[model samples]
Target: MDILILAILIATGTYMLNAKEQRKRIALLGSHLANYQIEKLMEALTDGYLRALGESTDERRQQIWSLLSTTEAQLTEQFSRFAADFAKEPEATTRVSRLAMAIPFAEKILPSFTFDMRKALAIHARGIAHVVQNTSHLAPKDRAFMMTAELFLMQHTCHWFCKSKTIATARMLARHQTPHEQLVASVSADTRKAYLTLIKGG
Candidate 1:
């Protein structure tokens, strides 16, 4: 009877260990899938923005505006889904890091475009930076919700700016100060903090 009990205990321990390993594998796969989806979404946005810039006429601008609107809708949907997934699996640090890396790329693309688009992109980038900095304090589920809301706002604003003809005039009338430069400085400060934390093994 003692031998049988020991055998049962060993089997139970093995089952638990196997379950833990399976969970880790599942988490890693989810993170990779999330990263891939985000990259695809960013590429689509970048392509749409570049196509808009390449167009030389107002009719082309309208077409580009439509494309941007559709892209924004898609981004909103994707962000919502990501938020849900993040909520379900709050321990996915790899997914969070992947999301954070996309912010800088988005920032780089923003400055390559026109004045109005650049400013709008800068605002969005700053908001994302804010989300990244604050996320450390948040429960993963809450962090995901916050990030999703910010992205949705950014997409909505992008669609509005792209579709509106008056934005060009507004861009002309607005102060020509370099907000993007200021945003970069701010982001660098946050990056420094992150680096320091990493070095300290925090």
Candidate 2:
């Protein structure tokens, strides 16, 4: 009976500590994120893509894509800056656990199971820049597909940092209708390679 009570207390304390740690990371990220309209841009691009894809007339579809091209460039520039600034943060503070579940002090306790988020953000930034800069190299359909995958994958990492890999994966499916594995597979080859390396602690 006494051991059971002790175990419950320990579990409760760990949960509180994990939540507190997550809040701190979220705040640190939010401070840099507040400077950019990333979420709004993402939403606009997503809706624009859908509208453009649904239009049957080539002329109207082309017009919609033309309008969204500017938005793509703007989002790319903003996210790149945000990633760069966030990377300036020390790696000690940016360590993310590879564990699927949130475990208090897991990052510190299992050093082998942690990865630096600075590298992850750098990977995402480069991926977005490549998709935007290679407009001529990729068809419109291909570009939109790759960009959506890249953004969803990036969002997954942000959620992972603030929460756990499990929660991140669940939210990705719930909000974007995309599974975590699908997001990884759908991203560009360059992104897939670099992101895989970073997450694997390479």
Candidate 3:
């Protein structure tokens, strides 16, 4: 009876430890995958924005705008579904707020004739920061390095969006780069290479 009880306790302890570790990985991966999806969705919106600017005809602009508006709605619905599916115990409540901050495109994806570029960039930066902060609890060996790398990728995506719109607006948005670029530049070469590899789907 004593031996059986000891064995059961040992098994329970091991299982508990493994479950905790698995939860941590799941949270990290959920955040990472959500960020990736956000980036790709933004890329599509940016492409639409650039296409709208390049068109010389009013009819084409109307068509592009219609298509983009639909895309925006679809992206939001998809993100909401993704979050709901992953909102499990011990993470559900926290995940709700984290995903909101991390995604940050509930309304911003719908571009208009006179959209506020500065405000959009600010929201984008905040989204990236929130994701990094939320996942920091995982305590990776190089958390700062990894966060900065992710930030750099995000900033570049935002910069390209603005730059594609026009050089003048891009110049104006360039001032928003001080903090993100500084940390991004601090990452080691290997870390950067690794980021590139992961980003490229390698």
Candidate 4:
């Protein structure tokens, strides 16, 4: 009976600690996110991509693609700025554990299992900018697909920063019906190489 009571106390304490850590991460990300319309821009660009792809006539399709270019540039600019700003945060505030579950102070306790999220965000910034610039002469459809993958992958990292890796992966699958592996596979070769090199955790 005593053991059971002690176990319950430990569990409650741990839960509270985890929640506190998560809240800090959520607040930090939210404060920066409030300064820009990254989410809104992503939605706009995604929808515009679909519309551009759906247009049947060549002229209309071309026009839609041209129209979305501005949005693409805007998203790239905002995200790069966000990443740059976020990277300036202190290491203590940006350390994210790679473990499957969130544990308060685990990043410090297990440095091998943790990584600096600033690096991940930097990789994402470069990937996004590279894709959006469309300098490789990729077809409109290909560019859209690659950009979608880049955005999804970036979104995944944000979720991971705010929660456990397992939770983040589950949420990505639930919301976008996209597996993390698929997102990685769809990005450009340069983006894929850099991302995979930095993201060694499950």
Candidate maximizing TM-score: 2
Reference-based lDDT, residue 39, model 3: 49
Please report, in order, the local distance difference test score of every candidate based on alpha carbons: 0.44, 0.91, 0.43, 0.90
- Give the per-residue lDDT digits (tens) of candidate 2, residues 1-202: 9999999999999899999999998999899999999999999998998998999999999999999989999999999999889989987789999999999878888988999988899899989989888744888878888899999999999999999999999999898889999999988999999999888878
Please estimate how well model 4 matches the true structure, expressed as its whole-model Cα lDDT. 0.90
Q: Give lDDT tens digits, candidate 3, residues 44-155.
A: 7656656765788888877786776555555444544443443432322221111111212212332221223233333334433443344345332243334434444445
Residue 75 lDDT (model 3)? 47
Error of 2 at 40 (Å): 0.8
Of the pair 2 and 4, which is ahead by lDDT? 2
TM-scores for the candidates = 0.34, 0.96, 0.32, 0.94
Candidate 4 global Cα RMSD: 1.6
Best by lDDT: 2
- Model 4, 5-33: lDDT tens digits are 99999999999999999999999999999
Q: After superposition, how far is residue 156 of candidate 3 from its true place, in Å?
A: 12
